[model samples]
Target chain A: MKGYLGIDVGSVSTNLVFLDEEGRVREAIYLRTRGQPINALQEGLRQLAGRLPENTGILGVGATGSGRFLAGIIAGADVVKNEITSHAVAASTLVPGVQTILEIGGQDSKIIILRNGVVTDFAMNTVCAAGTGSFLDQQAARLNIPIEEFGQLALQSTAPVRIAGRCAVFAESDMIHKQQMGYSLPDILAGLCEALVRNYLNNVGKGKEILPPVVFQGGVAANAGMRRAFEQALGWKVYVPPHYDVMGAVGAALLAREKMAGGGSTRFRGFGVADTNFKAGGFTCENCPNLCEVVEITCEGEAVARWGDRCGRWSGSLGYQDEEIRNAV
Target chain B: MKVTFPHMGHMWICLSAMLEYLGVNVVVPPPTSKRTLTLGARHAPEFACLPLKLNLGNFMEAAEQGADTILMAGGCGPCRFGYYAQVEHAILEDLGYNYRLVVLEPPRKHIGELLSKIKYITGHNSWREVIKGIYFGYQKARMVDDLEKQAHFLRPREVQRGSTDRAFKRALQEVIAARDPQDLPKVREKVRRIMGAVAVKPRPVLRVGIVGEIFTLLEPFVNYDLERKLGYLGVETDRSIYLSEWINDHLFLGLVRGQRSRKEACRAAAPYLNHFVGGHGQETVGSAVIYARQGYDGVIQLLPFTCMPEIVAHSVLPGISNELGIPVLSITVDEQSGEAGLVTRLEAFVDLLARRKGVVVQ
Candidate 1:
């Protein structure tokens, strides 16, 4: 009944994945973050605990995402790794011998080039939110259609309009202008998908050799229209693994599995932690001219972690909560 | 005249000590921060490079502190750095700072011209005193460089996390507070011992060379303390560009007595890049090849967003990487590169290098 848990808390969503001992996913939960990760995590954990079988044992937990440090502290994870590692790990595992990984998540998109199961190069979009899932969501809302339906609508387009995709602002205006120019919604939606994929290839995937056996994951990969565009853009078979949306969480679980030897126990705080009260607070440290804002998290009324200090004045002073024995120690 | 200049890493520490020693009143802008970047970005042309914006910000801050003169360095290049001084001067004048911008341009035209420019700061000091002041600055720069080098080597392997950083910071303070130039070498020796004395486990790890534009590579604020992030991930880092090395190569080449090595680096870079695109672009490629051939694990190219030279370097790096069989990661940062994203990429890079070698990162 023992299983490993992995959590990924990104700006747009929180994903929780449970894996059996054989490294196969048993359960996956993806929920909106809504700008508050703690609530989403707690709620996600609660739902997960409720769904588990009686006497089910959770062995190890791993966390990854933009909120990984905070998520790891809260989840009491055995390993805390970045989204890039998690995504790369998950993609490589899904498609053995994956040469490239294209992940376009809620807020950011990244290109990971791998060789022989090791990540060799990566690039994230710079300072512009042009080709990400959230932008897709925004466009869907403006188009007055459910985001889930938007991608399918793109598939119906007879001739997709060409929308400028260099910048997000430009893309939106172009989409509106196309809508006014009598282009069908499906055509416009398909055009938007193509624009985003083009943007991804030009910027994030720039200079990276797009070798075959490419695996595309992340929240955006759920959009079949985007997947088709990628296949055309790269002229290679783009494999969107079965669990496209929750790859980061799955990868984290796999990493946790690797970290745990047969006898090594996990740092998992147990499913009961879902009921525990966790509060986070922050204050700017005025001791120096840098004025660093140091944030601390309290679990059951005890300061467990501190971060965001330029010097170790704050983070070093506070006691960490069951920090990973070997990760970033 | 009370003098001030833009800050680049710890350049101010050495420059302040040297200028004060030469009897010129010095005004240092507040150490660069979010405020400085904001002020610079607000005032700078949107298309200008990050360093220019930062310098403008520093100059504005220094001017507010009643510094009447801007002592700046000048460059001539296909890169935009050489144009920084002139544009910044115009901006400050338009803002009515009433400051004299004294540029210490490179002596590509005449060595005497450079001498005359430096002579203004020499004042009533004897020629011996001027030489003494220059030597003193050189010693401090060399010491800082050596101490930093030692810390980089030790930090990844240090038994105590942040031990080398604390010791190095303490040593730098001693250097900054040093009243006599003669006290520099002793400080250097003492600090080197302290940093080198850090207890280390000496585990073999991936070695990464940071190759890119000079400003972004040296200034921790701009690159978000990249070296430390790599070090804590258990990776050893060596920078292709150092402020002291740049100074030695370009400004005081004769004093340091290095001519062959400069040509050697260019030659190393020549195979992949054949010609200099501008700034450190050639060095970035050359250093990667050098690191790859030397059997290093990988190279990370850090550049400011929209940096022309580094953009050229980025395009050429993968080809070199493919040819040499060493991996390269190019990280471009602007004002908005969040800490989480940068750290994630760095960790993933370290992970990649370690895994490729069949080494598990602890």
Candidate 2:
């Protein structure tokens, strides 16, 4: 096997990365999901497969992110892991001895505190999007500055304003208020970063032991403004991996490599999956008063996976062999 | 009069047992769901906790099905739960439901008062029979709790995945069918044997201690069947709150002058939170310390969004979570909590725990 394929289908972005047997990233691709994860995934995979060397044997596949289960069934992933694990693994693999990880994506932010390459504690944004990529993007668009230049502009600010960052709506309105008060755009952007960090610390990062050697990655990590704010707040240097945005996919591929090492046959249905017709539909299960909305995924007009059922009526009907997992303590 | 009560997880099982033992016609509100929540939210005041809305729904549905009297446990703490009965009653009255709302408050310092309240519900039971009925109800409550504990312990390790759940349902049905206390021993033995019969190949799993408000912790529908979700994720879930534990500590122990788990929880929580903040807030903090000290993997705190007592608990939990070196995931649930979003968080938390323990997660 020459390489392994990893797909990470998130709410805002779909990432695909191919890692060589040596666990080195060979190709990395990122595509905006825009509320259509399947299309984003298919386009990303097709581009990824087309770019790869001809006849490169793919041994195994892994899927992660919010849509791991869905992407796993679609891609025939050998290992379906969560984004936290994927991010932590990729962070650890990239920056050895990483003690903490801060990931802010489009819709959520997470803080994973690690001890000796193991994720010890983690907290994700719950019902809050204040310290996320989308919020930052919105702020940038509102300022009429390209998001790519917003960070650099913040770096030029001599006096940063303080904006409320506990809620996205309040933060946005606060930024507008700061603007009306004649604060420089760069200063407001810088203030936004500080507020975001404050909100993240007060919420998800609360009660966590964040040690040094912190690795910050995700779409938001591209912002030098946020990076500087983090340094000023925590007084610690934050390292961004080379393939930051695609780290989840990289971790997935690495995990796939680890699992395939156990000598099990690859579950990779091949790049042919990119061309497969996938349709998902949901129905309310009236078997009980709970009225669980069962989601069914069909490929080529045949049901391949079913979930969202509180009971095992549909999930148990199909016999899909998953990896042997440790008993939950 | 035909009596019913809003759902509180498995409390219905024990409450039903109590009513039946007292020889009253009992109608359980249909198991809580979207319909129940909608009806409750429609009638309940906005800003009320999820439990209040759920209970209201339960009562209305049960009333629609012919129940004329509603029995509910009332509280009198810093928590807003105590006044729920009065407000719910008014709402029901405004909704034009012809039903009686009987709020059962703790007798506090008197066992006689508690017994009298029971007599009031039973209508005409002799003192001796009331005692007998009380004894039977307590036994069933305990049995259900025990059976559930075993199910929690065994569900993740069951070789056939959901076979343990199937066996548990069967065992619960058998236990629920017991008409006499004597029948309990037989039922308990059968349940033990059946749940024990499931094959196990347990290596190790994350031991998650679930703590927080009593309502969301107990009512699966309210919290999206969190225990079941965790169990299927291959985690051992031990809830710190239960109806039996509540009755034992808050009611029985208070009146009978006996000790239960509350003292120990309070003791454990002393360093982090010395005073009770009302409701289960202190318990939630203390339970995390207790669970952490017990070598558990992590703790998950589930609370209704905007719950005061739980907010208090949430404030103090981080200190203990840090001091005790236990990872705590605080999940605040409301009516709009999406199941998929919950699953992702749970999966991530479980993955974090497994990775922490050096498990080769797939």
C-alpha DockQ of every model: 0.60, 0.53
Candidate 2 lDDT over A30-57, as tens digits, reads: 9998988777888887998899977888
lDDT value, residue B311 of candidate 2 = 96
Regions of candidate 2 where Cα sits further than 4 Å from its true position: A321-329, B109-113, B254-260, B360-362
Model 2: colliding residue pairs: A327-B205, A328-B234, A328-B235, A328-B236, A329-B205, A329-B206, A329-B207, A329-B236
Task: Please write out the lDDT profile of model 2 over residues B1-362, one tens digit for every residue.
Answer: 89998888888788788779879999988888889999888887778899889889999889878999988887777899988988888888888888887777776754576666677899888888877777688778888888888888887777777788898899889888998777887888898898888888855767999999988998888888888778878788898876777877876664534424777888888888899788898888888888999999989999998899899888888778777778888898888778777887888888778877877422
Name the fnat for model 1: 0.65
lDDT of 1 at B111: 72
Chain A TM-score of each candidate structure, as shown: 0.97, 0.95
Deviation from native of the Cα of residue A52 in model 1, angstroms: 0.7
